[model samples]
Every structure is written in structure tokens, then in C-alpha cells.
Target: MSNWLLPESLADILPAEARRIEELRRGLLDLYRTYGFELVAPPLVEYIESLLSGTGADLNLRTCKLIDQVSGRTLGVRADMTPQVSRIDAHLLNREGVTRLCYCGTVLHARPAGLLSDRELLQIGAEIFGHSGVEADIEVIELALASVKRAGVQHARVDLNHPGVLRSIIDSDPALADFADRIHELLGTKDVPGLTELGTQISGVQTGSIQALIQLASLYGTTGVITKARSVLPALPALHAALDDLDVLIAALPGHEFSIDLADMGSGYGYHSGVVFSIYAHGWHDALVRGGRYDGVGRAFGRSRPATGFSLDLRKLSSGLPAAPVAKAIRAPWGTDAALVDALCKLRAAGEIVVQMLPGQLQWLDEFTVDRELVPDGGTWKVRAIA
Candidate 1:
């Protein structure tokens, strides 16, 4: 086997793609900063318990675990950064008022999320803690929309759902309790036949619950689906509250297209407590952004706080965008003379790309284009257009 061969679903990002990903990272982080979100970076690895706290089983399956050399305790490479950020907000910062935080880091997944996904992701996101209102949900959703827009994604749409709606219905019948996770999976794929099989196979499963699951499958479309859900779904207050939450978000964010999927569970993390949403654009096969209200994820850290936030993989985001333009550069010959050194410093300080050539070095730059040259003209260095 070739030594340079990488594992499936993992590949090294070369100069062009790496530069584009970096640019997107900087722009998104700067955007988060403008919203008053203070940046935070959690450790790349932590004790398994701390890393997996308050998240779903899916995250556990994705996390790569190892033995700690010092304590012999199990450690986990984080597959998601949200829980780690929650721990920080709850234990480290411990602020009493509404606290906004942002983070950018690399996450390792044990397996690829999808056919086209890389196991490694550059995850970047912003979170709002200490506020549980629909207002906080609105703010995060707006920021998520703004993020893809800042990345030049057009025709973006938001699909909203409330896991509580389905969760309440499942809770209404005790027989469905043990199969909750399986039911969520079936509903997520809108697998009506799979759900029907579940109804026939499970002992003591309620006929009404199975019927509601089937009905919920088709309850995805425009805002009108919310009204249809009320009529079709069981008359449970929690279910209605979930629908109301989606309604409020739609009202709060007018002029943006929205679709409601009552059956859609969530990001599989299972911590979302209120209105959850995904941002989708045309070019991407999957969602560009995912976020929502997760008010109690901090409980495991001994301090529960109302939190809402969203995150997206910068690598995935960069993959769908148009290719980044080659950076223009002023090619200069290597020299230690005071005048040449000063000229190079001044050009760099003035925000110019200056590539100094080494003796016998090849001029190969896929990431930059030498559009001009720095040369000695009449005992002074001058930048002239390259011919």
C-alpha cells in the first residue's frame, strides 16, 4: 500500500481548497463577533463522560474513544463541539445574564456522516445561553441564515420542526416508550411502511399512536402544515406548543421561505428542546446549517442554562461555493540588501502578496498568481506589471 494513501472519507485539503476554507472560517467568525458572541475554544479531547454529556446516542457512536495515558480514564475525540461549549458556559464562565458565545474547531467523527462527507469537519458556530425565549431562537436562526448568505449562498430556505411534537405523541402512549429511538429514525426518513411494521410487531402499541405517526409523515410542506398538524395530530398541549413555536418563528422571520416538517425529529443529537431548524440551499445535497433551542444541555455540568445556537462545517460549506480566485502576487527576487528588505516589508504591510523567489526554486503556486514583479529600476525597487 502507498504510504500517502489516506483512509476512506478522509483526504488532505490542498492549497486552493484550504485557503477557501480558511477564508470562510475567518468571515463566519467575524460575523459571529459582530453579533456580540464571544469566542471560546474547548479542548480537542476530554474525558469521555464530559464530552458526551447531555447529547444523544448518535453523538456517542460518532465519537472516537481512546485510553488516557495519565489517568487511564477513557477519553473521546469530540464529534460535536456544542456540548463542550455548554459545559464552558455552565461551569467556567457561569454568567448570570444572557451570554453569547462562539467557537471554531476541528471535530473527528468515527464514521462519515454521509456519502460525500469527510470524517473531519471544521465546525464553526455561535450560541446564546441564559435566554429561553422564542426571541433567542429567532436571533440564532437569523444568524444562521446570515452565515450562508455571507458565504455567497443564494436561494436559501429554512425547514423547521419541533421534536417535542412527536415526542409528546409518543409519550402519550407508554407502549411506544422503549422504541422511541427507532420510531424517530422511521419518521425522519418518512418510512411509512417501516412504521406500519412497527405497529404490527410491537405488543400493546396504541392504534392511535401508529395512526398519528402515519399522518405526521405527510405533514411536511409550507406554513399551512402547522394548521393541518393541529387538525390531524392528537390534541396534546405539548404538541400544540411545538406547533406554536414554529408559527412564531415564521412570523418573526418574514420574507424568508420556510417549510414545516412535523415528523422531522432533529439533528439526531436529541438535546433540542424547542423549535429546531435547518438551512438548505440549492447547491448543497444536505443542510448547510442546523441549530435550535436546547435549554437544558448544561444540566449535566451542574448548572442548567437556556441555550440556542447553530453550527456548520466550513469544509462542506466551502465545497459548494464557487472556486476561490487565485490571489494576486508581486514576485520578488531573494535579497538581504536593506533596500530590498524594506521594500518587501512595506508591500506586505500594505496588504500585498509578495512571494520572494529562492535561487534555483521553481515558481509553482496554484494558490497565487504572479501578476506583477518587484525589480531594481534606477537604484530603487519598483513593482512592474509582469509580461
Candidate 2:
């Protein structure tokens, strides 16, 4: 095997894609700023305890562990930045009012989530701490959609799932507890055969509930899906409340395409307590953006504040973008003339990309090779376009 072989699912990003990712990052961060969200950066690695403290056991499983030579304690490369952000809101900043925070960075997951996903993802996300109400949830969902819109994904569809409703179904009957995991797995993957078998395993009141839940796995298409669930599912308080939450969202976002997937079960990131949403664009097979509420994620730090947020991999999001624009740069050759140096600096300050050439070095930047060159004519610096 080649010594340079990268581990499975971990690879480098090339210049073209890297430029697109950075552009998306800046635009999304700017959009966050418009929503009054402040930017924050957390260290890539942290004490395992702090990093994995409150997110969930799933986060712990994905975290790559290491020994800190200086402290002689185990540290973990962050698999998710949510827990770290929670710590900041609850422990460090401890801001009194509702805090709006945004972050963009690379997170290392031990395994790739799917065939299309990467092990190392450039995560861009926003968090709202100190808000538990559904209004906060609405804001998060809106922001997620807005970010994708800003990324130029025109045909994105969002599927909203409420696990609490299913949680209620599972908790309502004690006998159904034995088959919960299998049921969740079947429901999430839409395994009708497995679900049919699971339905047979349950008896009495739980039997009817299991069958009703199983049928929902196939009930996804349009807004009517939500209405159908309200009409068909057994009337439970949790399900009723969750439907109302969905109602508010549907009303708030009129015209946008959204579907309700009640059977969307828990994942490795376990703390999501409310409506979890996934956005799928036309070309991408997987979700381009995802987030939900994790009310008590900060408990391990000190306070268990109400929190909700959304995150999208910059690479994945950019993959759905219409096209990557080429970089525009001006080539500056080596010269002793003070005017040439001053002109180069001025061009850079004015937001123009200026690439200065070194002595005896051939300028071979073919990509983004603009015809425009900085040349001096009649003792004056000017940008002249070559034929």
C-alpha cells in the first residue's frame, strides 16, 4: 500500500472545491450576521469529557480519541461541534439573554455517514440558546432553509420528523419496549417486511399502535402527508401535540415543499428532543442540511439551557450548488519600481486578487489566468488586457 494512502472516507479538498467551500462559508456567515448571530470558534480537539459530555452517546462513538502528551489525559477530536457550543453558552459566556451563536469548522467523524458523505466535514451551523418555545424551532428551520437558498439550491425539499410522537407511542405501552429498537430501525429504513414481522410480535393495545406506526413509514409525499397522519394515527397526546407543532411550521412556511415523516427515529446523535428536519436538493441523494432541538445539551457543563440549531457540511452543500465560479486574480511580476509595489498593494486592498511573481520564477497560473495584467506605460501603472 502506498504510504500516502488516506484512511477510508478521509481525503483532501482540491483548490476549485476549496474556493467554493470558502465562498459558501462567507455568504452563510454573513447571512447569520443578518439574523443577529455572533460567530465563535472552538478548538478542534478537547478533553474527551468536555467534548462528549452532553451531546449524546452517539457523539462519543464517532469521536476519535487521543492522549494529550502535555496533560497525560485522553482528548477527543470533535465529531460534532454542538456539544462544544453548548458548553460555551452554558459555561463560558453565560450570557443572560437569548444567545445566538454561529460556527463554521471541520469536524472529524470516525466513520463516513454514507457513500456520499465524508469523514471530515466542513460544518457550518447556527445555535439558539435559552429558547425552548416552538417559535425558536420555527426560527431554526427557517434559517436552515434560508442558508440553502443562499447556496443557490432551488429545488430543495425538507422532511420534518418528530420523534417525540413516536417516543410517546413506545412509552405508552410497556410490552412494546422489547421490540423498540427493531421497530425504529424498520421504520427509519422503511422496511415493510421487518415492520410487518414486528407488528405481529406485539399484542393487544400495542398491536394496533405498532401497525399504525408501521403504515406511516410509507406515508410520505407532500403536505397532505401531515393531514393523513392526523386522520389515521391513534389519538395520543404526544402525537396530537407534535401535529400541532407541525401545523405551526406548515402555516409559517406556506408554498415551500415539506413532508412529515413521523417514524423518523433516533440516530447516533441522541439528544434531539423536538422536530428534526432534513433538507434534500434535486441532485444530492442525502440531506444537504440538518438540525433540530436538543433542549438539555448543556447539563454536563453546569446549566441545561434550552437550545436548537441546524448544521450543514459546506462540501455537501456546495455540491448541490449550481456551479463553482472561477477565481479572479491579477499577476504582478517582480520589479524594483515603487509604483508597481504600491499599485499591487492598492489592488489587493480594493478586494482584487493580486499574485506577485518572484525573481526567475515562471508565472504558470493557468486557472483563473485573466488576460488583464498590471503594466507600466508612460510612467503610470495601469491594468491592461492582453489580446
Candidate 3:
């Protein structure tokens, strides 16, 4: 006999954690409903082409690929469900007006994205398609914040960004091309020394633009960050427009603590083309929620629609919750008594969990916190709290 060993970053979720995950899943979906977002479930796997059509393009290396047995085409285990949801919004639903959709499911990755991570993560998110405006961005951002609150997570901050700002600067300058990747990396870390060294290497690249770009790395915190950026960042028309969009977002999010991070450059997947945002809890290094405007993610579906969405790992949020309310059961002994059967059915129908204890299953009753027992009370069965 061979011993079974699970792959790295793959493990079974015990009952307690599973329960919490399920609870948060329901909590998040319920929250989306209040905003009129309809829930949709895409498949766990799909044709490689359609699966990687939109944001999935950024997830090419992350997805697990296999040949489809029936169609002889390639299939991919979804690395991200946002692309699939976009497909639904474009082809299946085909609504001309704005379409808001939410989904919860497990997405499989070829390998763990981080040192301590899972290959399969439960992803929950909401996306709005067809509206290309800062209003959609605000709605997604607000929903992201509301999701954290609903998950019982406290003291978290959402850092906002417009990757287009930095991207615009890179694309506009030919000298910045070779050093683009390194500069973007350095900027994200606020590495002044690295930027200085690199800037010194690129001769005659306009000291003003280089200095302004370096300044962006340090520009974060409050609405003042946007004001500061407008003054420091290069006066490119694209940069100015992106800053204006930032101002709108800041004004809309008054009283909500958020910081600007122009150097973020969107998610690791790089699908975000407009406003990008990530939420980080007080103690956690990783963002609990990440999403943004990928306005044309549905382009591959033959119909381009503006899209913005946010997704988080339910398993991660589950652990952050204080506790899950476990269900208590009423233990009913095995019997043919009409009174007992009717009592059990009625109790179950009324939403009270009644567990019928089989001959040898009495021990299992204790496992579910069986706090009550059904017993005969003057010829009528009644429930009494176990003492």
C-alpha cells in the first residue's frame, strides 16, 4: 500500500474552517444582492481560448492546461473567474444596458502564487459591465469596503491607483523602455537610490519628467496625494485625465480612508486598465480584496463592454472572522411513535435542526453540540435542553 501525500499548497479544509468559508460566501453574496448584482456560476474549466480571452490573458502561466478529450481542443482550469463572468455578460446574457453580476467558486492555479498560498483558492467577487465611468469604479470600491465589513474584518484600508498614470509615462518616453520594468519595480518600493542610479544611466531623458516620475513613488495618502500628483507628475494629457479620474474617486469616497499608489501598476495579472484598488487588513500583509476597471475585458467575446470588479479568497477571509455560529441540534431517539415522528418533522420544518439518533449514532449527536433532547412529556413528545 502506498501512502497518499497531497501536493504542496494543497490541503483539506477541516470542518471548522469550511463552515466559516461557507458563511462568508453567503455573507458576501447577500451583500452583492442588495446592490442589484445577479449571481452567476461559470464552469471550473473551459476552452483555453475563451478562458484566457480577457483578464485571463494575464493568467496564462498560472492556469493549468489539458487537452479536451471530446473536442480535441485545449482546456484550462480557470485561473480567474472574472474573465468567464465577462464572457457571460457579453454572449449569454447579451444585455445592452449595464449588467451587474456576482460569483463565488474555487479557481485552480498551476502553482501557488505566494510562498504560503494554496493552489486552489475560493474566489468571490462582483462585476459590473457596460458602464464606462468613474461611477462604476466608485461602486466597485464601495462594494469592496462593504465586503470587508460584512466579513467581520476590522481596520482595513483600500489603497487606490491608476496604473495608466505610470504606464502612460513609460509608453510616452522611448528612453524609459529598456529600464521600464526595473523603474516600475523600483518605483513600487519607493527606491529613490535605484531610480537615481537608473536616471543617471539614461542621459538627456528630461530631468523634469524623471524627477516627476520618481516623485510619484512617494505620493500616497489622503486626497492631498492627488493634488500633490497633479503638481508633480508630467503634464501629459493622459496623465492629467487619469489624475482627474482620481480626483472624482477621492471626492466620492469622502470619510473613507484610502491612499493613492500610482506605482502599483495594477494586479500581478495586469488586466486592470483603469482605476485599480487593493484592500489590506491591519495585520495582514496581503490585500484581502483586489479589483479594478478592465473596461474592455469582454472584447474577445465580440462585444466590448466596460467592466470593473473585485474578488477575494473566501478561505482567507474565513480565518479573519472571529467565529462562526455553529448549529445546535435536538437529539430525537429512534422510534415509531406517531407523536415523536410528527414532532421531529415539525421541528425540522420550523428551521430547528432535529437529529434523529440511530441505534449506534448516539455518540455522533455530541459532535454537533446536541443541546436538546426530544422526550415524551405526558404522551406528547417535547424538546428539552440537555442538562
List the global CA lDDT of all models.
Answer: 0.92, 0.83, 0.84
* Clashes within 3 Å, all models in order: 0, 0, 0
Flag the better candidate by lDDT, 1 or 2: 1
Name the regions of candidate 2 deviating beyond 4 angstroms: 199-205, 266-270
lDDT of 2 by residue, 88-142 (tens): 9999999886999999998999888777778999999999999888988889889
Clashes of 3: 0
lDDT of candidate 1 over 168-278, digit per residue (tens)? 988899999989888888888999999999999889988999999999999999999999999999999999988888888899999999988888865552678888889
* Pairs of residues clashing in candidate 3: none
lDDT of 3 by residue, 66-96 (tens): 9998999999999889989999999999998
Cα lDDT for residue 242, candidate 3: 88
Error at 296, model 1, angstroms: 1.2
lDDT of 2 at 253: 82
Model 3, runs deviating above 4 Å:
56-58, 177-179, 200-204, 266-270, 362-367
TM-score of each: 0.97, 0.93, 0.92
Query: Who wins the lDDT comparison?
Result: 1
**TM-score (C-alpha) between model 1 and the true structure:** 0.97
